[model samples]
Target: MIRFVPADVGTIGQKRKQVSRACNGCRAKKKRCRHVEASPKDLDSQIQAAQLAKGDDRIDAINDDYATSPTADSSTIPASTRPSLQVSPSENTRNPVCQSTMAAPPQDTLAPRFVDGLNPEGVFLAVHSPQDTRGAFSHDRVGIWLADKLNSKEKQNDRTLTRSWPQSSLLAGRHSLLPPHESIRNLTSIYFKRFHPILPIINESAFRSLGPTDPAYILLQQGICLVASMIPSSKGHLFLGDSEVPLQHREFGKRVVSAMRISTEAGVITDKIVLIQALVLMWMFSDGPDARDVSSLLCARVVQHIQSLGFHVYRKSPDQASHYESTMLCCVWAIDRLNATFHGRPVLMHERDFGIDLAVYIDSQMPCTRLFLHVISWLDKVIDMYRPNAELRSSDLEIPFDSFEDLLVQSQSLRIPTPLLGQFIILISLPRAVFSLSRIWLIFSPKATIETLYHAVSILSCRPRSFNTKILSSASRSRRELSAERVTSLVLDKQVCQLTYFPFVPYAVSLSLSVAYSEMRHTKVPMLRARARDKLQINCGLLERLGEIFYLAGLMSDMGKSTLDEYDRIYLTAVEDYQQNYSGSCAALDSIRATERVEIIDNSNAVPSTSREFESNNGVNGHSLLTQESDPSFYVDLPDLDVFGLFDPNFNLDGIDAYLEGNLNLTYPTNF
Candidate 1:
């Protein structure tokens, strides 16, 4: 019925006009649109291609099932009212249009299929895998898997499992592994009060909040217990409820190892600041024949952790750091550096590696920490000056003298404002003794040795009377407080007495004594020689006093003990020789007194003699008269006594025992 209208054909080469039309939906919405007509086959092919492009093959099957099936009510609906199957080319890439001949499923049935996988609910369920056991993840199972992956054949064969994972169960323990909570609290309080002022590493609040099972807290607790056991006060009846309390140090050390194992199993050994703090405490408490070895190993481990944490390069961000972290880093660095110098091992870090400046830190808010940092810096310079391979030129040794003097001045000026008076005194005394020791090592002269000896005395004097009296009083108190059973049970205790509050005091005293002994033997001036002899006696007396303390503490260094024993032999020999020589002098004086008596008898009536006339006429003090008779001015003019001995190459401590012993008996009290 359509009439074909004749086309108005444009002339040849005329431009053709483009045609466009809007789709039904676009037209309903009144928006501009362009639509292209597609054949049914092409539309079907495009829909299939889109379904395949979605990467989920399930979509294709769903589409096919929908296409084949129709609800009973669907046929009643007109096909013309249905949605179109065609899609624009632009829409094909995003959402494909499918022609559905059946009614769509209920909204609830289709809602889950369109749920977003990235949503929290979806992600949690996927990770938890409620539907599949094989896909589930749990912390224990994950830990086991990690352990299996990291556990190597060599580790298995050696059976030396430094890492904690596989043996965690064995390492874990109940309350038996620790003291009672109250005991732990007391020890921890003691540690923070005594050691923390100098080494402020553990955060008090955080440490308190940690549960007993936490590896870091347990390790810290064990360290605290071990250090507290070293205190004389802790060994008394005050903590003697259980038989085990006295030997808690041994148990605490084991627990520390166990805690380290746990931390290693937790895969946080080298990552924890608390572990480093614990190790530092352990190192400080360690002593024995193997102390050097233990300290070296401990220091190495600490450095490893410190380097791993990037603390050597850590700089403060704009945000201020917590007191715990900053103080811990600073203290650890100082400990490592000092340990290196002491052991003659290579240092783990240099001054430049510090995040904070040592000079500035010395002047900062933490006054107690200043002494440690200052001493560490000076020790670093000392190490540099005396490195093993470096040539000991005169200039090389001379240059550091100024620095040493400056350190002495600085240390002397420091006023520690800490409640721990004993620890504070020791900390302040250490640098001064170290400076004196450095001088003794660098300059081998009587002047230097005597000066160093004087300095050692000064350090000893700096200790408050309370500290010295406490040593004697504490020993007696502990013996009285501890029952015989408890005292006997402490057999395993490795109590070590530091010879001086500062380590260098013993070394300086020994050197001074040796030098004084040499000068006493070789010096030509009788009075000067006598003065050196007196100095030797003074040094020996100090050694005897120190030895008494060491004996009471049940602690003595090999060096100190040997020095004491050798001095004893020398003193005994000197006393024996002096006694023999004094007997001969007494015989000579007796003969002279007899002759003086004869002279006094002959002159008594002539002079109407007083006691002064008797001494002037006959010289009744025969020993003085004999000395004057030998050399007129021997008793009158005395040479100036140099305390530090001459650095004579031929000087030796050999065969000086008689001289030392004689002078010692003269200058020292017989009770010593």
Candidate 2:
């Protein structure tokens, strides 16, 4: 097998040029024959030339080649220095991008794009001092730079504002976002059963007493109905047909927004507790995979409310709300940790900031809630252990008790609720999925060869020692396959069902789907590929199921399928290269196996394709997942690109790279 190393930008014999070699005048006396730098047309030719060259392992550096594409703006402002958060007031006022961004939204494609939270539209990357190189000093800067780089590849992908949820739906004459009065009772019941246990913010008795008439309870009731509508079976549909469900959802959403505004912005705080609960419940509505989401806003207000109420520093008191406050504080901290991890922001509500004794309350809670706390507690430690931007290395995943297996044991002993358990399967499997993505990163990084990635992806099918000496020798323990097996088993054990309804579930499902894509696309062994294909179908079903209610999941599903289709088209080209290489006649293209396309098998429930011929060809006993042959014909083939996606573990980098190019048929110039 040839080691396949794709240069970021290259043509067969041509090196990618930031500046053309012939810088001098070629039309004039032809003195030096210097190469002139590429125009947009030249860059396109250079990439096409690299594709036709059909050679691999041309360059070792991380992919750096990009030019102003037809989609990208022709000009950029050069960076004189990096901006700091603590800049003086005068300097901040002088920055027009900040003022313009907030005061008026740009309607054109040339509007600035935000990197991290700040706009990097007009800035060029500045050279760092000797001590401040890439991936040094601050992991955050490295992440921001990577984001800027990928965003440059997708400058024109921003959707027009009109494509979002209709403003008329929310702002139209006095239409409340809530369901009908009778429907409210049903939705409230659904919310308590489906969302309340996990969230534990709202008090059941207060809602019963206030009965949606009071301003405080009104907002709280609206929030409950808004989130509950995500349940396809929640019966908040207002007797409108299924086509009207989204409209019904928007109405509920409208009611929640109106109720919150009137209570908080328009009048005095009526009841602090009710207000906080409503804010917390509304947090799920801030992000949508497919729509324009206010992802960075709601969490901050929720944090402020918690701190303002002194929930962060409360001691058990004679007050009737003391117990509720304690539980709510713990929930806030846990959710804060999740938001920090999910959004790549700093943790706003840290454990150190809390004055409450959380463990006592956690221990006294229901088993399911207790299990949720325990899971989140371990996650906090993991987040602390690694910078959200640092790539996982071979040695990094040897998680010290707290190994994922321990969490599994704890969950089983506690009898975690089935829905939360489904969420847990998604949650605990996260580190491994992220670790697996990190494995893919090794393929591009200077650390390892592409073959190592193949071995890592096939961990679920391989024996413990099969690749340990080559791949895991650096780590103290071999945990790669064990983690993979656990993920497979957890998903296989349960029927596909709705995970706890929240913004995070669809996003997590998206991440898991990306891992399946890595395995499906990169595995060299046929049986492993087949197994991966099966997993892809299951995850796709899961994502689509969630997509029905969550706009983000639906957006992700469409994006994943489109990207896979693009990769499959490219794969056929590589397959031709692979066939030629093995023929011993075409060495230039042999290493690029187009036949190794992104496989999207039809269903997960189909019987495994195990046959005596397959076992013999792969030289494995019937039990081993193998097909000794590398021939494309040996296994079933997919005629179309069914689905493919990437959820990078570097959560900070997740929103960029994979998703920036989403919704468009954009392709990285390097890979064929």
Candidate with best lDDT: 2
Candidate 2, run of 10 with poorest lDDT: 441-450
| Candidate 2, residue 181: how far the Cα is off, in Å | 2.7
Each prediction's Cα RMSD?
Answer: 27.0, 25.8
lDDT value, residue 541 of candidate 2: 70
Instruction: Quantify all predictions' global Cα lDDT against the true fold.
Output: 0.45, 0.47
Judge candidate 1 against the unseen true structure and give its global Cα lDDT, from 0 to 1.
0.45
Q: Point to the candidate with the largest TM-score.
A: 2
lDDT of 2 by residue, 1-672 (tens): 896544322222445523323443664766655343223443443343333233222321112221111212223323434221232344335433322222321212122222332344323332322221223224333222222333444433433233222333333322354556667778777777666766677777767788434555556766777777776666435432123443544444544555555555443344567667766776666434323324445667778878888876766642434666667777777777656645555678766776656776676655545556666676565555344332344244334535433644554434544543334234445577675564221011100111121122223111112221223332422344344333333333333333345665554455445555655654566566666655656666766666666656666666556544454444555455444454453332323322221131333334345654575476443312221233445344433322224232433333433452221111111000
The segments of candidate 2 whose C-alpha lies over 4 angstroms from its true place after superposition are 1-175, 235-264, 267-270, 287-293, 317-321, 388-397, 401-498, 521-527, 570-672
Local error of candidate 1 at 279, Å? 1.7
Q: What is the lDDT of residue 660 in candidate 2?
A: 27
Residue clash pairs of candidate 1? 446-644, 446-645, 447-644, 574-661
Provide TM-scores for the models.
Answer: 0.48, 0.50
Q: Cα lDDT for residue 532, model 2?
A: 60
The reply for model 1, stretches above 4 Å from the true place, is 1-167, 171-175, 237-245, 248-270, 315-325, 352-358, 361-365, 389-393, 399-672
